[model samples]
Target: MTDRKLALAAWESLFRAQHEVFHDMLADFDGTDISQAEYDVMLTVTRSPDMTARLRDITANMLISQPSVSRLVDRMVTNGLVTKCADPDDGRGSLITATDAGARAFRAVATVHGRSIAERMSALDDDELRTLRALSDKLRRS
Candidate 1:
């Protein structure tokens, strides 16, 4: 194949692989208090100190758009999963913190999801996983 064709083929393969893996992993959220998106946001929040993060930071980390993330965070607030407050440092910006309930829910789901991810990814050896991670990071940087 020509270089362009080869690149297209590689992209297609990567996209399909991601879709399949994501679809399978999404099942782990079934019967959980949070959807995949909420879990994603909570994951970032939980990783931060005191389970708090700026809304902009969360938006930066999430794949969703800023408006969508704002709406989602509002829903999460309504569901008692998290709290949204004005950023003390920046009045125009907002801060998000996972509630105790949210933390509990995240922990409950994370245990299962983490294992599921590991099991699914086990098909790739450590070196392959590392290479994949590096390549993904490179792509994101680019």
Candidate 2:
């Protein structure tokens, strides 16, 4: 195969393999009890000091759309894991805040996710980890 064609094929293969490994790792996560999207939103909201963020803030980094985020926030609110509030700066916008209970839940789920990542990635040497990070970043930027 030509060098360029071979390289592209290798990249595609590697990307798929990486995605599969991530899915496997996610499957083993303690937050498997929660949908990945839900866990992501909760973690983001709870990590901030205000423990609150606008709907637009959540949607930006998330994989889902604003409407989906709103619906998920609604469900989380109903579950008592989060509460909806008016954005102080924008009354028309909604802000999401984790409850004390939500914070506790996020902690529990984070532990699980952390453990899964640690266990699966533990075999990589420091140099390998650095190389992986560089490569991943390069792909992200591209």
Candidate 3:
């Protein structure tokens, strides 16, 4: 294959692999209090200090659109998974803080999800995993 064709093939393989892995990982949420989207939001929030994250930061990290994220956060608020408040630093901005219940739910799901990811990635050795991570980061940085 030409260089361009090789790149295309690699891209296609990466896309399909990611799709398959993500589909398999979704099973970790079975019977959980949070959906995958909610978990995505919580992943960012829970990792932040005090389990809080700015709405824009959450949206930036998510694959969802801004409106979708807004709606999701609103629903999360109603479900008592998180609390939303105006950012004290920026009047026009909002902040999201994971509630105690949200943290509990996230932790429960994360254990299974983390294991699932590791199991799936077990096909790659440590060196290969490091290379993959570096390549992925390089692509993102580009």
TM-score of each: 0.96, 0.80, 0.97
lDDT of 2 by residue, 69-137 (tens): 888889989988889988889978988888888888777878888887777788898899899899889
lDDT of each candidate versus the true structure: 0.96, 0.82, 0.96
Of 1 and 2, the candidate ranking higher by TM-score: 1
Looking at candidate 2, what is the lDDT of residue 108?
81
**Alpha carbon lDDT of residue 62, candidate 3?**
95
State the lDDT of candidate 3 residue by residue for 2-111, as single tens digits: 59988999999999999999998889999999999999999999999999999999999999899999999999999999999999999988999999999999999999
How much is the lDDT of residue 94 in candidate 2?
A: 84
- Candidate maximizing TM-score: 3
Report the lDDT of model 3 for residue 72: 99
Q: Please estimate how well model 3 matches the true structure, expressed as its whole-model Cα lDDT.
A: 0.96
Weakest 10 consecutive residues of candidate 1 by summed lDDT:
1-10
Model 2, clash count? 0
What C-alpha lDDT does candidate 1 achieve relative to the native structure?
0.96
**In model 1, what lDDT does residue 141 have?**
92
